[model samples]
Target: MKLQPSAVGIVVADMAASLAFYRSLGLAVPDEPAPHVEVPFGALRLLLDTEETVASFDPSFTPPTGEGRVGLALECDSPADVDTAYERLVGEGYRGHLAPFDAVWGQRYASVLDPDGVGVDLFAASS
Candidate 1:
């Protein structure tokens, strides 16, 4: 079976807040749709959805309770970008999960949470 990923959907508690956060990161809402925004990350696109919309799939699905429950990892072009992105998230009112640091796997990384409390990791391979 050939498997291809078209999108990654994030169930957000507040669509407006989530959209604003993503837009602050330079993602653009597609012209075709009035509300949804699309952030292209290489081969995949990140799709943000409201709680009500996500409940349509599974009524029992709920937002993560605490830290590190759901994470979205994004690769950066350079280690500096990881630091920059992390700082930007913090400046925009996102709580930092961890400060930017060199990972055991040789990548520089940091994490932040979205409006829905979903974790987002920014990383770049160490040279």
Candidate 2:
């Protein structure tokens, strides 16, 4: 059988923190903690697993170090909305990686870090 893209799984250290981060980004994930939680976004399901969940089967699961090991992006309705989202997240104590700016590529772009220190970008085209 042919293989097609299905899900994106992220092993998180703290379920509550990770869930809060994704929920702030407008994902409909519930504000609950679980060893493994799945959220369906359109066609792809976002799979969240705790450190123990991964290690349960693999036994060799060691969380990778360093920042930006994973990248997630969201597109807003307009350039201004991108700034609003970025500011709101930062205002809530999340780390803002790059302040909102008009990228040379014809889009407003910004970035913020999640609880796991992964960079999540916010971008939108000029309207």
Candidate 3:
């Protein structure tokens, strides 16, 4: 048996806000009222679905109420870029989970929560 990574899924409370937040990070997502929306990344797809969508299919399904359900790391061109991206998202009203800092592991890293509270990480190799 073999396993392959296919997609990253996020359950959102508000489609517009979720789409806006992702667009700020350069994803070209279209505005649609459909319960689900997705953007392609090479061979993988980043998928977003509304809580209502899940419950419609699975009446017993319960959406997660805590953090850490998802962790998405985005690479920047440079350490400074990581800082810039983090600051931009924060300025746009996103929650900054962690300020940009140089990790002893040899990279600049930071975290921000999307509109739906999913962790979106930014990182770059220390130069």
Q: Which candidate achieves the best lDDT against the true structure?
A: 2
Poorest 10 consecutive residues by lDDT, candidate 3: 33-42
Local distance difference test, each candidate: 0.77, 0.90, 0.89
Please give the ranking of all candidate structures by lDDT, highest first, separated by commas.
Answer: 2, 3, 1
Candidate 1 residue pairs that clash: none
Could you give candidate 3's per-residue lDDT for residues 1-127 as a string of tens digits?
9999999888889888988898899877886646899887557899989999989998998988877888988889999999999999999999999999999999999999988778989999999
Judge candidate 2 against the unseen true structure and give its global Cα lDDT, from 0 to 1. Answer: 0.90
Give the winner by TM-score: 2 or 3.
2
Clashing pairs in 3: none
TM-score of 3: 0.94
Highest-scoring model, TM-score: 2
Clashing residue pairs, candidate 2? none
Alpha-carbon RMSD, each predicted model = 2.8, 1.1, 1.2
CA error at residue 6 for candidate 2, angstroms: 0.9
Q: 1-127, model 1: which lDDT tens digit per residue?
A: 9988898876667767777777766666443432345668558888766667767787797754665566788888999999999998899898888899999999999988777777888899998
Which 10-residue span in candidate 1 carries the lowest summed lDDT? Answer: 29-38
